[model samples]
Target: MKKIYYIILLNLLTVTFSCSKEDDLEPTDIRYDYFTVSPDANDEESILRRKFYEDHNIHLLFNDTLRHEQRGTYADGTPHWFTELLDLSYDITSTKNETRFTYIRDHQKQKEGIRYAETYILPHLDKELRPYSIFLVETLEEYGWRWNTVAYYNGKRCLALAIQGIAELEEEEIKERCIDIFYNIVDSKTNYYDEELNDFIALGNKLHGETFESAGLSDDPTDEEIYAFGFLTWSTWYQEFPSESSDFTSFLKAVFYQKEEDFKVQYASYPLILQKYDIMKEVVKQKGYIF
Candidate 1:
C-alpha cells in the first residue's frame, strides 16, 4: 500500500509539472494578415509589368492595391485609415492643413507608359541604373496650383502622366516624355565625369563671380546671364550657381540629345561649352552608349 501511494503521488506530480510547463509556454512568433490586392497575373497591364520586371528587375506597380490600415477614428465616428500614397508637397502660403491622395486608375495609360519606358527609356539605361519601383498615377498636384509629372514618395518614383488627353499625344511628345524620365533616372544615379564637371563649374564661377547672385543676377535671371554662364538650358540654372551634379546632367543632355555638329555650331563662340560637351561625349561613349 505504501509503494502504491508513492507511485500514484509521483505520477500526479509528473502530470502537474507537464501541465504547468505547457501553460507557461508562449508563442515566439506573431503574424497579422493584411488584406491587399495585387495585379492579376493574366491581365494585360500585369503581363507588361511582369515582363518589365523579368527584363530589367524593375517593379512597375500600376494596379497593386496598397493595404489600408485603420489609424484612428474621426470626430464624426468614421475610421481614419492610413493612406498608402501621401502628399509629399506642402503649401506654406495656405492656412488649411490637409492631406491629399492620388492613384493610378487608367488601365490604358498605365499600359502605354510601361510600353514607352520599355521601348524608349530602358534601352538607354543599364540594369543597375534603373529604379526599384515606379508608381504610375493620374496627377500629382500641390494645392490645386502646380502639377508635376514625376514626384518621389517614400523612396519610390511616382509618375503622374496619365492626363485626360493621353491617347492624343504625338509620337514625338511621347518620346520626349520618355527622355525626361531617362534624364531623371540618370541625373539621380550617375555622378558625371568628376574632373570635367568641376572644370565646368569653375568656368561658371569665373564668369559669374563664384555665385549667380554675387554676379548681380536676380532671383529670376535673364536669358543672357544663363547663356553666358555656360548653362545649356534655362531649367538647369537656379537662384545661386547650379549644383555640380545638375551641371553634369545638363552637359549630358546636350551631348546625348543634340547632334555634335549642331551643338558646336550653336555654341561656336563659347569655348567652355564646347570643351564640356566633348567631355560628356567621351563619358557617354565609355558607358557603351552610342548617342
Candidate 2:
C-alpha cells in the first residue's frame, strides 16, 4: 500500500539521516570543471546559481543546458547540499493538500527543523547570517508558510542551529539579507500583527524615496525597487508598499518603485514596459493594494 511504503521510506530516511548527521563532513572536492550551456549571466536562474556558488562554493546543476557553456555542476559527482534537503521525501497527507499546505504538516516538521538547525547552527553560523540573506525565508513566504513566528515557536532549537550554520559562512552581505528577511516575515500581518496592516503600508510609502537612494548602482530607482519591489508593490502598490523589502531592493537597483527590470535594456526591438505595467496593475489589485 502507498501508506505502508511511505512509512517504510520514512524509517529508512531516518536511519540514513542519522548517519549523515553524525558524519558532518564537507564534500572532499568543491570545484566544477564541467560546463552546461546557459544563457547570459543576466538570466535569473543563472544569476541565482552563480550567487549560491559564490557564497557557499557549492556547485549547482541546472535541469537544461543553454549555449555552449556548461550551465552548472559539481566538479565531483555527488549530491548537492540543496538536493539533500529535498531528499527527505517525507509524505504529506492527501487531505492536507486539498486544503492549505501549512509548513508543519506532520512529523516532517521536526525532521526538517533538525536538519536545517544541525547543518546551519553556530559557531558555524554567523550573527549576520539570518534567514533573509540566502533568500530562503522570502522564498518560503511566497508559498505562504507563514514561518515567521511559527518557526521560532515550533522549532527554536532547530532555528538556532540553522543560524549557526549561517555564522560559519563567508557571505557577510548575504547573511545581512537573510536577517532582513527574518524581520520582514515576523513583521508580516498574516503571520503576526503588531498594528493594522495599513500602518505598514503607510510606512512603505513614506520611505519610498530610499528605494532610489539605496541603489548604490549607477541608476535612478522608481517606486518598484526590485522584483521584490514588484512583488511588494503587487502586495500593496496602491495601499502599503513598504520602505524595506520592495522599496529597498529598488533603491539598491536605482529605479522607480514602479520600474520593471525584466526587459528594460531590450526595449528597442520590442515593447515590454506597456505590457508589464498592465500586468502590474492587475497584480496590485489581486494583492489588495488597489482595493
Candidate 3:
C-alpha cells in the first residue's frame, strides 16, 4: 500500500508538470529566423543593373550596396516604407487624397506616365519562372496596407525593389519570418515622445477602430495580419500614452481575445506600449522599434 501510494503520487506529479509546461508555453510569442540566399538570386537577370556600367563590361549588373542605400531613406525626408504625400492645398479630407511617390528614383513617373520602366524599380522584381513576389502582392492587395507609390509597368516600384534580390534568394522560412517580423512590427506599440514618425505607425489601427463601430476583425486573419493588427494598435496607443498602467496585461488579453469592443474602450488605460517600446529600443536599438 505504501509503495502504491508513492507511485500514484509520482504519476500525479508527472501529469501536473506536463500541464505546467504546456501552460507556460501558451503565452510565449512565436519566434522565427530568416536566412538570405537563393539560386535565382545568382541568376544573371536577377542582378540589379545600373543604367551605366563603369566596369570593363559595357553592360551593368545588380549592385547590393545601392539597394541597401535606397532602402534606408524615406521619401519626403522620413525613414519609413510608406511616404504619404500630404496635400496642403486641400482640407484634412483631401490630405489622404494625394499621389504617393517612391523615394527610390526607379518608381518615378515613366516618360511622364508613358515610357520604359524606371531604373530604380527593376532591382526589386522577381525573376522566378512562375508567379513571384506573391507575398508582396498579397500585402499590397490588402485594403489597409496599400503600396504608397505609383504603379510602374511591372507593379508598385518600391514593392518591386523590396522583393527584387530578396525574392529570388528564396528561403521559405526567411520569407515567412520576414512577414512575421512585419506583422509583429505593425501590431506592436509605438511611442509618441520618442519620435514623430513612430507616432504615425498607429494611424492605420486608429482609422480601423474609428471606421468600425465594433472592433473590425474578420473571422480568419492570416498569422501576418493577426500580428499586424496587434502591433499597430499597440503602437498607436503606446505613442499616445507615456505612463504605465495596471491594465497592461488585461489590454493584451482584450487584443488577442478579439474583444474589439473591449479593446477600443480599454486600450486607452494601458500605457505599457510606450514603456515596452522604450525598453525594447534600449535593449535592441537597431532590431525592433520600441514604444
Top TM-score model: 1
Better of 1 and 2 by lDDT: 1
Comparing 1 with 3 on lDDT, the higher-scoring candidate is 1
lDDT of 1 at 239: 57
Q: Native-vs-model 3 lDDT?
A: 0.31
lDDT of 2 by residue, 1-291 (tens): 999999999999999988988956799988544332134567654565465445544333232122233345577864433222321112343221111112322234334433443343322333333232121221121113442322221111112112223334566543443343333322321211213333333434344534333434224434334333332333333333344454333222222222345545533233322333444334333323311
| Alpha-carbon deviation at 42 in model 1, angstroms | 5.6
Q: State the C-alpha lDDT per candidate.
A: 0.59, 0.35, 0.31
TM-score of 3: 0.18
Instruction: Tell me the tens digit of each residue's lDDT in model 3 across 1-291.
Output: 999999999999999988888744474666421112232454432332322222111222122122222245565786545323212123433222333222223333212111112222222222321111111211111112553532211211111212323324445543343433332332333333335334323432443223222245444434344333334332233322111222233233333333345544444443433343333334233323221
- For all predictions, the C-alpha RMSD in Å is 10.0, 23.4, 23.2
Best by lDDT: 1
Per-residue error (Å), model 3, residue 221:
50
lDDT tens string, model 1, 59-124?
Answer: 666633445679889999999987554223323444432323355566767777666666665677
